[model samples]
Target: MSISPVNCPNTDCYWSAHGIPDKYTEARAWHLAAHRAEEHGELLTAEQVAYATRAGHTLPNCARTAAAVAAAPEPIPARWDRTVILPEHPNGDLDGQTIVCCITDDGTKRPIGLFLDDEHREALGLLLVDPNGEDEEHATLLAEVQRLKTELAQAQEDIAFTERNTLPELRRTVEHHQDGKKRWRDRAQKAEARVAELEAERHTTNEALSDAAQQLRANSDRITELEAELTKYVGKEPTIAEEMEYLSGCLNAVRDLCDATEKQATRWEHPLPVPEWVETVRAATDGVRPDDPNDNRHRILVDGKGNGWISVCSDEGTEWVVPIQPAAHVEQDVRDVADETGSLREIGRCW
Candidate 1:
C-alpha cells in the first residue's frame, strides 16, 4: 500500500483497517514523544513517559482499534497494550531494556517473538577482524593522542613558569613598599594593584589547563579501548565490516516497500461503524470459549434466584460471568444489562 509521508511504524498498523490511519496515528504520537524526549538528547524507552501507558488516552483508543490482521479470517485479537515489568540490570551503568509484552483476553502473558530488525540476525554476516586492521587504526590514533599530550604538557609548563616568576616578584614589591617609610606608600599601593591583576590572569589560565587536561585523558582512553576491541576480534571470524555491508543489502530488499502505496489508495474507504456483528464473532463461547476472560459474571435478582446471568466482556476478558447458579435464582441487574447489550439471552442459552 502507498504509505503517506506520515505513517505509524508499529507492526499492528500493518493490519488492513489501521494501515490507512496508521500514518497519522503513528507519526503524530512518535513526533509528540520524540519532541519532548529531545530535551534529554537520548532515546526514550518504554519506561519513559513518551511510550509508557497513558491510560486515559490509550485505553479508549485500543477499544476502537480494528483488528484487521493480514489473511486471517478469524479475528484473533490484535492489541499492543500490555503491562511490562523489566528485570533489574546487573550493572547499574546499563538501563533495563524495554520488552514486547501482551496480556491475552484470558489474562495470560504472551510475548511477541520474532526478530524484526534484520541487522540482529546472525545470518546477515560475520564480524570481520583482519589481523592487521586493528594494528593500523590503533597506531594512527595512538600517535595523535601522544601529540596532544605533548602539547598539553607544554601548556602546563608555561602556566607554572609565569606563576613562579611573575607572582613572586609582584608579591615582594608590594611588601617592600608597605614596609618602607611614607615615601614608599604610593609605590606599595601600585604594587598591590598589580598583584591583584596578575592573580586574576593566573586563575583563568589554571581553569583552561584543567579543561584541556580532561579532554586529553578522554581521548587517550578512547583510543586504547577501540584498539583493544578491534584487536580481540581480529582473525577470529569473517571481517565485521564485510558482514555489515552484506547485511545492509539484504535489509533493503526485505523492506519491499516498492509501489504498494497506490494499491491501498485505490480502494473505496469510509467509516464502518463498529459492527454489532463483531459481538457475535467475538463473544465468549464457554469452555468452548470461557464465559469471559475477566470472569466478572455474577448472579442477582431479575425477580428471584437463578433468573438472570450477564456476560459483559471488557478488554481483559473477565467473562462478566456467573457460574453454577440454578435457574431458581434471579439477578435483576443481569436483566437490565441484557436488555441493554443483549447478552442476557446468551445466559439463558448456557443451561
Candidate 2:
C-alpha cells in the first residue's frame, strides 16, 4: 500500500496559485483535489493541464519543494563514493560493468562491487551464452506477451463499460427500440446527443471513482503506519484517556474524604450558648465565600467516627483544611486567648 502524491497545479484553484500548500501536497489531499477537478468541473492550472500523465494526476509548478524532497537520493557511504568503468578489471564478463569502489587520492583500490573467484568467473562465462536453436521458442514467448497485453486492454474496457452502464440498461438498449420506426428515426439525432453527454459524464465519474479509491488506500496505509509507530511507545507513556481516568480517581477520593469529614464534624454535640472567646475566634477564622450560600462561616466536614475538618480561606487567597479536635481542645484555646489579653480581663477585653 503506497501513495503517490500529486500536486495541484491550479494557480487559481483554492491555494494552488501561490504555492502548493503543505497540507494539499500530501497524497490524500492531492487525490481529493483531483476528484474535485473531475467531479466538480474545477479548473486546473496551465502546467497541470499540460503535464498530467493521467486524467487527474497533474504536477503543479509549485511542486518544487515536494519534488526536491522526493528526488533526493538515499545517502551512500563515503567508502563507495567513487566508481570505475570496467578498465582495471578487463575480463570479458565484466566488460560493461560500472563498479562502485573506494578510491584513494593516489588511486589505490578499495573493493566494493563484485569480486568473483576463478571458479565462479568460469561458471558465469558459460551461463552468459544463449541456448542454441531457441529462436522459435523466443518468438512464441514474444507473441504470448503481446496477446496478454491485448487481453489486459480488453479487460480494462470491460471494467469501464460495467462502471458506466448497468447490465439491465445494456440489455434493454440491445433488445428494444423507442416507439414506431418513424418515431425512432426522428429521435435518432437527439438520442445521439444524449449518448454523447452520458459518455462524457461516465468518463468524469470513472475519474472521480479512481481518485476516491486511491485516496482511501492512501489513508489506510497512513493509519497502519501511525499504528505501527504508536506500538513503539505503548508502555513508555500513558495515553490521554488513561491519564484522565487516573486523575478522575484521585479527585473522587479527595471528594469522598471531604464528605466524610463534613459528616463527622456535624456528629459532635454542643451546648446552647457558645463561649464569648470561642465566638471571637470563630468570627476571626471564618472564611469569606461570596459565591457560596453559607458565606457567614467556615465550611466543615465530618466522618462516621466523628473526626472532622474545616475548610477556610485566608486573606491571602489561599484555601486550607483544619482538623477538628475534641471540644476540650477548643475550650483550652479559648482560655489561652482570654489570658493573653492585657490584665487578663473578661471575654470583653480588647487587645
Candidate 3:
C-alpha cells in the first residue's frame, strides 16, 4: 500500500517549504497547519480551515480573512485509493488495472473489484484469517478468570486477617492515646492549680511586706519625734572642748572673787566674816598661803543657804577662802546655781 504525503497549507512551515518526500502524513500536515496558525502567527486560508475542521483538527483563534472565507471552495470529500501492479494472465499477458479502496466504518481500507480465482481466493483467505482465533480467545478468558479467582481468595484472606489483627490493634492504640491524653490533661490541671496557689501566696506575701514597710516608716517617724523632744528638754549635748571652756570660765570667776576678798581683808584691818564651810576647807588644806593667787587651784562651793565660798589650794595642801554672801532677801540653794550655769560641779553641800 502506498500513502501520498499531504502538503501543509502554511507555506512558511518546514513541511511545506523544506521537508523531504513522505515527511508529512495527512494527519501530520493538518495538525502542523493548525499549530502554525495558532502558535507561529501564521494565518490559514478559509478552505484549509474548513478542511482541517472536517479532518477533526481544531485550530483555536486561527486568523483568516473575511474575503478568504467568502471565496473559500466547498469542502472536498475524503477518498482512499491504491495503485497495485497487476499479475500476469494465464495467457502470459500483463493486465493493467487500478484498485479502488473504500474506508470502512472503523476507518480501515477495503479494496473493491479485486479479482482472484477460486483456488487462489481460498488460499489467500486461509493465510489472512487465523484458524485458532476462537480457541486462543477462550483460553485467554479462562486464564483471566483463574487470576480473578486467586485475587478474590487472597482478598478474602486479607479481610479476615485485618478483622483478626489490625482492627483490635488499632482500637488498643486509640485507647492508649486517649488514656495518655487524659493523664496529660490531669497533669495540666494540677499544674494550673499549683500556679494559682503560688500566685495567691505571692499576693499575700506582698501585702504582708507592704504592711511591714508601713510599720517601719511609722517607727522611724516616732524615733525622730522622740529625738526632737529629748533635744528640747536637755539642749544639745556639749562637746568635750566646749565643756572644758565653760569650766575654765567658772574657775576664773571664782579666782577673781577670791582676789577681791583678800584685798578687802588686807585694807580693812578687820577680820572678814567667813562662812563655816570656808573654815572647814581652810582646815583641810593646812593653812599654807600661796603668793601667786592666779597660780592657786580654787574650787567654788555653794552652801544650802546660797553662800558661795571659793576654796583655794596651794602646793603645801594649804587652803584659803573668800566668802560670797547671797542677797539678804532671796534664798537660793547650790542646786539652783547648778541649774543656772550647767557648768558647776558640786562636790558636797556647804552649811
Q: In the order shown, what is each candidate's alpha-carbon RMSD?
A: 64.9, 42.2, 25.0
Across residues 211-329, which tens digit of lDDT does each residue of candidate 1 receive? Answer: 99999999999999999989988878865445544643443343332223333444447633443433343332211244443544442212122233444333342334343345533
Better of 1 and 2 by TM-score: 2
Residue pairs clashing in model 3 are 285-317, 288-318
* Sequence-dependent TM-score of model 3: 0.32
Shift of residue 68 alpha carbon in model 3, Å = 80
- Model 2 lDDT on a 0 to 1 scale: 0.47
Clashes of each: 43, 12, 2
Per-residue accuracy of model 3 over 3-102 as CA lDDT, tens digit each: 3444456566443222213543544455455555544656776677777678644444445645766679964343434322234434321433322233
Cα lDDT listed for each candidate: 0.43, 0.47, 0.53
Candidate 1: worst 10 consecutive residues by lDDT?
A: 56-65
lDDT of 2 by residue, 151-194 (tens): 97566545533432344354456666544566778799789999
The residue-level lDDT of candidate 1 at 42 comes to 34
- Deviation in angstroms for 241 in model 3? 6.6
